[model samples]
Target: MTVLFWVCTIGILSLFLIWRNHSDQKKAKERFRDLKKTQYGASPNRNSGEEALSHVSHFFEDHRQENAIDDITWNDLEMDSVFARLNYCESAAGEEVLYDFLRNPCRLNASERARLERQIELLQTDGDVRLQLQYQFYMLRQRGKFSIYDYLHLLDQEKKRRNGKHFLLLFLLILSLVCCIFSVSGAPLFLVGMICVNMITYFQEKGRSDAYLSVFYYVLRLLGEAEKLERIHHERLQETFALEL
Candidate 1:
């Protein structure tokens, strides 16, 4: 009866989660459509804190070239608010890239400028292709409090993670399995104890590495979205962006 109850509970929870995901996706699509049609004015940038906003700027600040916009000019233009107005990006990573591009203001040659203009036109007119791409971007929501680049920087400074503890845990689990065949009662206790220890250790490592893991996950998501766009094969988009991904 308890087993049946758990099975039923799991089924219900799975259904609820699926339903919630679909509902969220529908809402996001609608919101994108509405914003595109109405041309909503930009509000102030979402600031978790001064520290977080600073972290978001780290990449652009660190990588400034000779031609990059000067701080004085940027502020004089109220570039932050201008960025807020221009940023239709769905992901924090997208926002970071846009910010960096604006900061570094590249000089596009005639061909490049024409290509960019054509891509912009496609995005404006091709609703289906635009929506498909936007949906993928929407899935990669903002990472509050810190940018992915910040997490990556932290990872670079940290010592490389070792697999020794994981190997030890696996060895113990195998030993416990062997003991189960020889001594059932003793083996059960040993196995349970080792399982508990493994759980504790796993959680400890996960807690310590969560930031690093999230950064990698976010990057993988961006790659996946790019891959999705590549598969779309929209003729005009192909000619314009020339997505090589």
Candidate 2:
């Protein structure tokens, strides 16, 4: 009876979680669409501080070279204000990419420039593709004051964990659940012990690699969205992205 109760409770909770996630995602997409409609060509309303702006520049700084704009010249040109004026990205990653583009103005030849212009033209004209890509980026939304690059740097310090113990614990958990169903003597106690051990192991692993886990999730989300982008079926956009689908 207790096992049945637990199973029912877990099933209900899982359904609730799935429904809530779907609801939230739908709401978010609608909100993003409304915002995009209202804010098109409008001046940016985001208040960017020096620290926040600096965080966005981490990727650019990391890959910056001799031809890149120097700090003195960047400040002299008041590029921060310029960045804020032009910034309309829905994610930190997008902002970082834009920042890098601005800082290292690519020396494109005539053919390259024409191709880039055509890409921009398509984005401006193709509302469906534009909104689709925007929503994907919006799904990759920034959280808090830190950029993805910040978490990525911290992730470098995190110790990598092997999956062997995790798999073993999972197998043991399943075996214990089966034992419980068969009404084996002391099976309930064994199941409880397995649950406790699993909880402890999970938290210990999370504590050790919280940063790594966060970054890994972010990267996975990014890649997932990129894959969706690749499936958009626009030949020009596919060429522009140059992603191997």
Candidate 3:
């Protein structure tokens, strides 16, 4: 066979394999999201879940109506309440309340949601959140380059690395992978580079759950060959809720 013919054939096969893998991964993600909706009995990202999760309704019902939280500021109390619930104790009772509130998720106004996000940021500004997440990573360190905690900490995700060292390492990995690919057409150097890049990107986000997911994905793929996946709690992903896990 001609050299060009072989090159074309190999290139086509590589493209086919890469595309297949990507399609499968995306499908898995969609299926996972749908499963979550079913299990939580609420739609993803919808506040409907929060409404059903409220525990205060009963308490407040017995109290005088004048002191009841009004529509405009109830969201604030919810934010504070979630924070207070998380920080003060790692109690299942509190979590049950959160779940109840989230089950019929309250419709937090856009401004209110943004405010809560800021509140989460301020709370995490001290760095304890990151450390606890890190400890989770180290605990699951045996799972190769990734960890279970990575899937749970989107807020700790590493940013895409832009540093000179990263670029240099990436360049070297790419060069070596390219040389190897052409010389030994069956190996997966490009995929290796992708794995490295994913890890780097995971760490760059630092405090994101996406970072944790990156590590989780890496570990699962490299070690566990895991098929099941779940999202971190909304608070963990957003730094909004304190968690015992």
lDDT of 2 by residue, 73-180 (tens): 999999999999988888888899889888888645688778778778888888777888889888877755666887787766767667999999999999999999
Each model's TM-score, in the order given?
A: 0.67, 0.68, 0.24
Q: Candidate 1: deviation at residue 54, Å?
A: 2.6
Q: Which clashing pairs does model 2 show?
A: none
Worst 10 residues of 2 by lDDT: 236-245
Candidate 2 RMSD to the real structure: 7.6
- Candidates' RMSD to native: 6.0, 7.6, 18.8
Best of the two (2, 3) by TM-score: 2
Model 2 compared with the native: what TM-score?
Answer: 0.68
Q: Which candidate leads the pack in lDDT?
A: 2
Question: Residues 89-205, candidate 1, lDDT per residue (tens digit)?
Answer: 778887787788789877456887788788888887887777777777877888876777777777779988789979999899889988987886789989998999999998998
lDDT of each: 0.79, 0.84, 0.47
Misplaced by over 4 Å in model 2 are 1-24, 107-111, 150-208, 239-242
